[model samples]
Target: MKLNIKPFFIAAVLFFGAFTSGFAQDNLVNSLKLNASEKSKDSFTFTEVINIENTPVKNQGSSGTCWSYSANSFLESEMMRNGKKPVELSQIFSARNAYLEKARMYVRMHGAVALGEGGQFHDVINMYRKYGAVPQSVYTGLNYGTDKNKFAEMSAVLDGMLETIVKNPNGKLTPNWDKAYAAVLDTYLGAYPANFTWNGKNYTPETFAKEVVGVNPDDYVELSSFKEYPYYSKFVLLVPDNWAFDQVYNVKINELTETIDNALKNGYTVAWAGDVSEKYFSWKNGVAFVPNKDFDEMTVQEKAELFNGPKEEAVVTEDMRQIAFDNYSTQDDHGMHIVGLAKDQNGKEYYIIKNSWGTTNDYKGYMYMTKEYVKYKTTAIMVNKKAVPAGLAKKLKF
Candidate 1:
């Protein structure tokens, strides 16, 4: 069925600003920070290798709109990279647009499309292109008096409305249904702006996006690696959150990891969609790596001391990655941004990933993932076409 291709994934990424000589993350790295591994005498030490300037960290809170949050975060960096002043884009504004669009599709497809809080990263860019963009200061989506995003009640009410509309109790759909659905969004997320003045200039969403945001929606591209398809081809990524069924370019695993390294080194940040549910992913500790020892085979002592220090990572291969992906071991559960690169004492590489779960982790809402871990777990990544290496860009025909 055309509607059966949904992947129930939720992405939760934030920004990772530059970590130069005096940047906060670099300073912390210099201190040899130890998070959960404090119990272990020997802890891991990280040194910044490559970093990019970006906007501040944000919280998705109790919502599953990390796709909007992460994509906005990456676009903020892209604006900075393009020499424009940084501004926080409204993540929920894009999400609000997506919700209505998703609703239209769900009803059109007889509820075959999944309806929930989760979404994929590309949805942000697509929404921006279609509905234009807005500033967070212009629309906060906090009408319920909460300081942060909490969507339980609103989502439940919206889902109930969608269920009724899909059932077509009247035996036929009416035009009023769409208007009624939009009213619920306005009641909860607040009425959106038709026009607003910013920095002494009056602008609408479209004008603001063109005059200030200055991002070429076409400049960015999404890519993934899967042995199921021929390398350098493109296919629809099968994930529940990919409700739009957008196709992503396919490449070898080595090329996939190299693309990120090349982007970080060349003043670009990436939006990551992947699985972080492995025994080794520790968001609280702000450390993630593919350990040589498998969790299932490890003894209690080994499991307890997993983060004691740098250890050998699994030699991730294209075949192994495909196996895990096929068996459901690797899932598209969460999403984040790859803002920089770091190296441990053992010289193993880690991607400096920033999460949208607030500034709560050891790195202050920032975390690290081994390149091996990323290669093994990443479902897909979005980056500027220019950020891709000249040779690889030609190969992928980006």
Candidate 2:
């Protein structure tokens, strides 16, 4: 969803310009400084605390293909960690299967479930189980001949198909509704092979899933934090993209980040789902941070200028995460994998993120998200249970 933030940006700038003269700071980085150097020195150090393993980032272009890209990347890492040859599983293949499945579900629910450019991580796992998967080179889903996914045209067509089915224009649900949905997918992303040869043997999608993508679907777990839910209990995440109603473990927001940091420190990667719509999220700069509240204590004009760029703070907490979600500040925006940790020039901790948008940005498709940013913006995270601390693992019933 490309938002029009021009007006907001302009307003924010004018609001801040009035204070620039009063606070003629020495350096650009120094001007936006929220915490004193002395205060910052007391904050946690990620490199000193956690170990990380990472690879190059990937890009999913303009499509809502992050679900596939991120999950497949996680699978790739799983293969690597397990000492198997890493293979780029076809994201489009998983996408086509999910697209068809979601359409059927939409018709079943009479268009109640969302039918758009978004989905949950478990959708990939579920689709892989039911329809199997393919290699990237085998099914890229670029029927229009572009190198990357540009789904605007096809999405409209698919949306139209689902809308038509959900209406039941003919007044009777046909048994072949799913077939019609599958036809639309086949037209866009080539027909799935019933039997294809790979590695000198015939294989179907199910067999390929069983043999190639060896990670067990049951091994992965989703975790989130929200005050309404009882801590240490499991509940379905209420995001629209979670069409499967997948249950995620609910923890206190502090525990969520603690577990994530602990997992990364122990050399385990996390599958992350978070909101990326904030102005502070600079994909080009490869950073995500929360605006400084202490700086906001400044005059309105001063606040506006700082808002135009980046500001750092440590207000990220369990309550902050819940309040953001309650106030519609955090949303289900994008998904990625946090593979490592790094610090900025200010020495603040940042989780090294691998995005699915292909290597197109200055950070080559990665984002360094701060601890506060993760606390305030995350929707959910998936990590291996073994990576969690023994105490936390016991609380989670792992």
Candidate 3:
């Protein structure tokens, strides 16, 4: 469904910032910076069928802002895909702006909606459209005394303040409440800079966005497949972190993978959000595929050999996908970028996923997710409308 809305800030569910010095320079190691023996012994070796260049891997330390990191990484790739110079956008700036808006919404809803660090892919688009963009250097948002993001305390404090406002002992709101909220964010993230110098030039976030970033926010659309919603109709996704209640368009299950394959084949990357909570989703080995046998039923040897390479996987049917979603096996657990496609020794297809968790995995923070895993666990995807397949585009009225 690309209705229009798009969490964790990945497995609590996963995101990206690219091209500064470390990861950015490291990204040029190979298309994926693979070691000759990147895979474990007996593990699958992938030859990339389509490798779209993107910025380096990012580490979203101690925070659940993967939605921002992943979407911004997709946007960075989008910039590269369009021939713009690579620039890493600030993931935390989006987080800063979103916290303000989420607090306001929480008060409006009388504290009914869930509010925290988790968000969907479209939250980045919403922030970009509303506040424009800035380079990561312009607003690193590490002002709270750490070299990396650690949101546990800050988010809790912010939530506590919002809950107090919702209590409304005065039975009325004060104009300065939001101002106080902004001050707290400022204290932590530093004020969203009014203007900043970049490449020896002065520009505000909006100008930098228009002149440098050059992304057309409206060109992107969010989509998901759910049996509960009618295909091709716009419906607001009911997931808890989608506090804004943004809409998404629903479609048949196979169309989900078909659309992603078409986009990559045609030189576009996808912002993938879905369940990464499965036991078979081995982030360390950088491979994920559904086993034909259930996890609990697997023998010890079968479990040990799970990530050793390619194997037959259960054929995911529409009913099977629906069952996972209905029973909560499929959830909005993490977000990642789908950069390319690859196949194992047996010729099965896997999507090359760029994760935001850093280079801890075998593929240097890049991993291979079987198409079956994506089709079964995907909650939503936000992709450029121009990349939409021609026939499917018409069917969804894109």
User: Which lDDT tens digits does candidate 3 get at residues 280-353?
Assistant: 77776788888899977988777667777787899898888889888867767678899999988888899999
TM-score for predicted model 3 compared with the true structure: 0.90
Model 3 sits at a Cα RMSD from the real structure of 6.4
For residues 133-242, write the lDDT of model 2, one tens digit per residue: 77776777877777766666677777887788878888998888788777767776778766787778888888887888677777788888888899899998887777
Count of clashes, each model: 6, 10, 25
Rank by TM-score (best first) = 3, 1, 2
Deviation in Å, model 2, residue 286 alpha carbon = 0.8
**Which regions of candidate 2 deviate over 4 angstroms?**
1-55, 294-312
Q: What is the TM-score of each candidate against the true structure?
A: 0.90, 0.83, 0.90
Score residue 254 of candidate 2 by CA lDDT: 77
What's model 3's lDDT at 104?
87
Candidate 1 per-residue lDDT over residues 303-354, each given as its tens digit: 7788777777889998889998898777676678889998888787889988
- Per-candidate Cα lDDT values, in order, are 0.78, 0.68, 0.78
RMSD of each: 7.3, 8.5, 6.4
